[model samples]
Target: MATPYPTPISLSKTCIGWTDIGLMGSPMASHLLSVGHSFSIYARDPSKALQLQSKGVCLINSQQDLAKISDIFFTIISGPPDVCSIILGPQGVLSSLNPGGVIVDMTRNHPALAREIFKPARKKDSWSIDAPVSSIDVGAREGRLAILAGGDIIQWLSPLFRIMGKHMYVGEAGCGQSCKIGNQIVGSANPLGLSEALTFAERAGLDLKKVLEGIRRGSAGNMIMELFGPGGFAESLVKDLGMGLDLLESEEERAVALPGASLCKQLLCGMIANGDEKLGLQGLVTVIERINDIQK
Candidate 1:
């Protein structure tokens, strides 16, 4: 049996804050509320956050206000640029963040960016953690996300982490992001492999669903098929692949060769360039079938 995690720390005295409530963030915030962790939030479009408001989560008017009242702030924004602008920009979190407060960034951001943000936050006697989450919106809603966190505040935030998902402390400030990049590399590559196999199977006149079921019972089965099948739209995977490409660009400076990830990136870019970016990982089959001159 797996070891049971320690009891969660009471968050009654800690004022939590969540911003950028998109698909993933909304469910995550709701999970916290369900566990009785009262927190505040700031939404760019107030209407998107009305459901949260109805749950009695205090809605603040600005990032500064959100920062002022929060002892532990969470940001689940888009990417590096948004993370930088929201935390370092004028009237951003740093402007009014209390000394010794912790900022948990759950964005799938670049590790270097996470390190950069850590510097300034540290200078002001605050802390930052790169705790990018794993799992889709559905997983977030079910509180089954595997949260990879890197920073000094893991001990203090363990209780809250428990409420969200199975949490792992990867390492220092940017390690969580580094792990996320690695995750994307595998995640993107897996779909491509599945696409090729499925295409080959379909061309051989095999039942795709039956093949998936049999494969799932073996090591060949994976989350990609479980969540997206062969033609569903995987918005998160597309975004993660884009972020992986950015990481590769940075790695090139160090003479790192990620040929596999690079190839997957090219394939995904082709899908996007062809206006099929909205299609999920399974959609890669469309591109593969086209390349092989086979009809889906």
Candidate 2:
């Protein structure tokens, strides 16, 4: 019973509020501020958002306060539980959403949770969109994230989307989450394959740097290799892959198979076992190294 939200007049007229002032959210909010939008923001740690506060963005104390002032509320918090609590709890944003207000959740979320959020938002005569984004540290700072949005309101939201990153409206409220998870599943193959290839070259006494540089020019060249060539922390990958596997397990009747994703998960689990969970996707190389008994 979700309904389409009416589009607002213009960026200047649309009041924006957001939560999560962490690494990714900070730069994103900054972009919105850069455009001179009337913006308000909330953060558990007010100190984290002081820089933005000094830029004339209102620093509100709670989501409830945000809902009261904002026409479009955005959130990109830690997990589904926090997302639910922030939007559904007593003092949550949706509790006080103005008529026709919209909530855009940018967290990588479970599709089910995303759909559930749409219902209440609609009940309030507002709307919700699951718009999970992906970017590395540099891309985020540069506003080059890939935003996969799920909602009927894409056209209405495009102006805002353009400020954050490249965006595509995939489908209804939960579809963005599904697509993000699927992307994670497919992307896992890159790091896993890279790890295996590097491990093989090292065992053969080849120069690791030479092999990496050579791959950079061939059909094997990819953004993953470019981003994680020397190895970067992929702790978030653990969460992303786990979410995909959970979705698959929940939908066993679909009979879909992703053997590569399963293998990658196993390897990540091995990395976790060795207390190297803090390492990046490149750390998979270390896991491969351990498997082959390759010495330092």
Candidate 3:
């Protein structure tokens, strides 16, 4: 056999890409590479490019270069500012595109801005699609990503997207963003509850293991406990069973995790506020420590 990877498929793809590759994007790109999509990357930090380099991935010098070469450009950046600059700024991809090129912004951006990206791209015979994606590192590498797409271009890219995510078509322009934000609210449920549930145990002087057992293997059991739990819950658990991060990772949809989801934030805030702010965000343990100190 010649090779299973980089096989010449019926589709020809060239992508100018930017990704916040700390976790999800790594596996996503690996899958893209396996399918033989030529890519060019332009991240704010060049050091982030090394991992892709190790995988024999091609590096594109700038967003402009990306626009000049690729017919379909994609981005998975962290925030809106990053999204805007890559597509709209002077050094951005928009300034240097050939007619008929399209931008597939996988990052969930503000619905309003998503519309804005479409306006200019279309004027030049190009297009932009707000197809926000949701999946963790494991799913991306496995080509089992779940995407919430907005706009007609989805039909055009559906075949390519199948290589990245499971289909979750919501609707056009900003509807996918709406769904992605909603998904994050659901994703936050477990972590927020864990903070409160764990704090209560430590304050009561209950054995953490026993407390975990009491709640788990029962109705109180949740996805977070199942994955992050101590008894045989090692790194492989996350590796084996994938986590759905929601489209909340991208800029447009990041606040989607925020809007209309006050319960999780409120609970976490209460847990954190009962303790000193001096300890900072990951210091939920301080709340229990302080309450116990007072009781003693």
Candidate 4:
């Protein structure tokens, strides 16, 4: 049986479901509860579901059950596979969601699949919303995440997104995912830019601490400095934070492959990311030395 096609209908009767309740989704759903939207949840790990239960969120046994009951569906899983399993999988949410419900995915995932999820959801006359959240775990808890919602279910979604976080409607589905990747591009470069600037200051024999004080006063200041703290770009962060070696390698690949970054800068980035991220962007200093060593 096919669901009646909607002319972008608005939904006031809302039951929400969260696929993953860890990190961003936990606090995001918490904010939803605070605003009085009763939400059901499912997590791969029972403990995560239990944590949401302790916070008064309704916990369900399966993804299908969540869809059957929820007027709004949301997935915050880590990547593409989890997205497919919960939605397009045999026991997926689309199988159970009532007609005219809304499905919202809050994961950073491949855009094409997100767009494809809309088809079956629409076959049942349900709509899918791509609204991957922007912000760290800290921002999620603070209710300050920036939400990027796609699809024409704007009216149905606006009030709910308002409760969840500060938000912006990017476009239709996939638009949200596009913006997320764009953000990653800029985000990868922030620390690198800081590293180069600080290196230049140090090579000039300028005391970096004093230089930072002056730069922090002007346009040179940025969030990268704050994330790395006073050591600026040091190797300590990688060992301490447990950031992935693969991600650093990916950073180098993207720099060389991505449009806009100067080739010289890309080569420099490739070397630095290939080396170590904890060493801060300043790790480039060693690469620079190696280049001169080769020349000599």
Candidate 5:
């Protein structure tokens, strides 16, 4: 039986499904609510959705319920599996979303998966935009995230994008994920370099803070060092490195060589293995410290 899709609504008046209430998702959703957009949220823990609820957002019980009335559903879950299951599994978005609805996946997912989901969504008269976001939780909180969007609706969605941050329309369906992969590759690698430098400086008995200050004013200055240099989030490195590895694995057929990304992956894996996965990206200094000890 052909699934019945709801009539398309104007973007400004569209009901939205703001799924996934993680570190980044929470703030992103809050920004939408602040702008007076109607929202339907499905969170595992209702407590987390309380704040949004108080602000007139509806708390729903199931993904299907959220999809039923929403003209646009936004998902910013963790990994590819989570994204796939939410959109493709039984009673998932594809099974319930109205025909003219739009599904925007802002998760850092595999490009191939984005492309795969695009096909079925189109058949349902729905559109999918793989618009994985860049920037950390801080950026999301401040409504300054850099969004790389893929799909044909960039012009139509520009206003919504502006509510969160600046957006770049990359290309057709999966290009956003492709761009995100490129982003993770560079993003994951920078911290490792910073980790090495910081570890080396600390071992050399230099003032690490002063070292950062000195280098930040020189050619070595970068966002990674400035934002996550000494007292910044380090656990994000583990997540981003893992995502980078997953992106590389997805592109294995191409035989791309990414030694630095691989090395960062191993280091982050080592951190998880060492039970330091909970630490922020700056915790990579611990991994570097351990490696230096072994080398000594």
Candidate 6:
């Protein structure tokens, strides 16, 4: 059966509040403010938001203060714990969110936590939607992210969603996080496979550029190869994969099998051990090289 989506309402007059003005969130909030959303921000590290403030975005001192002024709150913090702290904490957004207000959490969090947030929002006559985005720094800056929304209120938030990225209404609360976990699982596999292949070709003394060209034109061609060709940070990937594996372990009934993701996690961990956690996904090739004793 199809789930019903609320009709999108005009948000022309809605006041928006955003938090966590980091690499991804900064640009996302900028896009909103650029489009004239009457935007405000609550930044823990105020320095990160100085430019936004200079551009006329109201920088509130606390989430409580933000809640009083914002009709719609958007957060894209680091993990589940921070999500809880910002939304459910003593001075969190929900502590004083106006009735009929909405909270859109764009963090890639545990699915269960997303659902946990939904209940209180309902009790207060507000709404919580989990809408994790899939994109890197450039994509976020360019507003080209792929957003996965898990809630019925998505339609009502369509105007805002359109500015951030292309969004898919997945299901009830928490489903967006679940889908993002699956996305990380699937996304991790491609880059790992590409890195392995590249490492092999390099070890065989093949011309890497020629080999990459052939791969790009061949059956193994994929978006990961195109976007990263051979580079991306392993730290974020490690966190995402760890969360994915934990989710699988917790859901015993599902019995899903994804050995590639596990192996990818291991290789990424190897990258971290080698002190290359700050390096890109192509750095995984170094791990493979290390395994074969091929010095860079």
Query: Per-residue lDDT for 214 in model 2?
Result: 96
Question: For candidate 5, lDDT tens digit of each residue in 1-296?
Answer: 12223333344566889788878899999998887776789987788888788888889999888888887889998778888898999979878987777889999777788888899999978888899998878889999999999977777677678989999999988889878877876766777788898888877899988998998999888887766733223455555555555554665335567788778767777777888767666667778889788342
Ten-residue stretch with the least lDDT total in model 3: 232-241
Considering only N, C-alpha and C atoms within 3 Å, which residue pairs clash in candidate 2?
232-280, 233-280, 234-280
List pairs with backbone clashes in candidate 5: 5-99, 233-281, 234-280, 234-281, 234-282, 235-279, 235-280, 235-281
- Runs of candidate 1 exceeding 4 Å displacement: 1-9, 230-239, 248-253
Which consecutive 10 residues in model 6 have the weakest lDDT in total? 1-10
Candidate 1 residue pairs that clash: 232-280, 233-280, 234-280
Candidate 1 clash total? 3
What C-alpha lDDT values do all the predictions have?
0.80, 0.83, 0.62, 0.66, 0.79, 0.84
Residue 296, model 6, lDDT: 65
Better of 3 and 5 by lDDT: 5
Q: Which stretches of candidate 2 lie over 4 Å from their true place?
A: 1-9, 229-233, 251-253
**lDDT per residue as tens, model 4, 1-296:** 12222432233335667878776777888887776666678887878777668777777789998778776787887677788888889999888878877778888766667788987877877788788776666678887777877776676567767776777888977778767655544544565666566667866888989987887788877765565532312332222122222223443223224442233245345554766444444454455545445232
lDDT of 6 at 44: 95
Worst 10 residues of 1 by lDDT: 1-10
Query: After best superposition, candidate 5 residue 128: deviation in angstroms?
Result: 0.4
123-204: candidate 1 lDDT, tens digit per residue: 9888888999977777788889889999886986887888888999999988998898788777777888888988889889
